[model samples]
Target: MNKFILIAAVFLLTGCPGPMDPVPQEYPAQARLVDNKVCITVPARAGDKIFSVQFGTESGREIYKTFGQPDQQLPVVQGQCLPTFDFQFKPGERYAAYYKLTNPHTGPGKLFAARFSLEKSENGHLQLKQYSRSEY
Candidate 1:
């Protein structure tokens, strides 16, 4: 009886996940064209930082440059995450934006990439359109 109880206890404990397990972190971001520049916006969280931003053509032929700072920073909420980064890039053409987000508390970072394009409206205005985005 004692041996069976001990085996059952071990199996139950090992089979179930603990409440202290760390949850996977997700970093969501968006991109658009503002005044002929690509503006990348990312939600900010405590201890989370944008490591790098790389811009290139949709074909991935040429990479322009890598940036580390955002052109604008919004206010950080106390307990809520808000869009706090605005990285602007003057591509002057269709391009893709790639970024990496990291957190010290987490083990590794996540990679996010997005492609965008611009179209002229009937009113003779440039409009920004995002093709697709992927997270890895």
Candidate 2:
């Protein structure tokens, strides 16, 4: 009975996870146009000191840049470590958002999503969808 009581005490102190606790997932990389800027969300840390994020267009044209923390990067917070910037593009104009994360010790990370487009749509008199990424 002592073992059972000890187990019960441990379980009671630790508590249990709620239904809403989300588990983390991983992906390669991607980008989307939101509002006035194209944001790229990459779940990675700087392999070394000075992580550099280079962005470009579908035709391999330069778009934006971002520099991450030095050394081994800290655990990324929700919605953190994202590179966002503005580029002049016409409506309905297709764009390719590519990024390369670079550090001193490691080479650039691979990029995907080369067929993204900047689009604007009106849902109602005041309801307009700008950004594509939505957090639940």
Question: On residues 1-136, what C-alpha lDDT tens digit does candidate 2 reach at each position?
Answer: 9999999899779875556664333234445444555555565554522233444444556755544545443233334435334455444554544444444545544343333555555742211123222310
Sequence-dependent TM-score of model 1: 0.49
Alpha carbon lDDT of each predicted model? 0.55, 0.46
Off by over 4 Å in 1: 1-28, 34-36, 59-92, 133-136
Model 1 lDDT per residue over 1-136, tens place: 9999999899788875667665544444566655554556665556665565466664454543433454432333333432313433333457666666656677576665666766667787767777644521
Residue-level error in angstroms, candidate 2, position 39: 2.0
Question: What are the per-model numbers of colliding residue pairs?
Answer: 0, 1
How well does each candidate superpose onto the true structure, as a TM-score? 0.49, 0.39
Model 2 / residue 28 / CA error / Å: 4.0
Q: Give candidate 1's whole-model lDDT.
A: 0.55
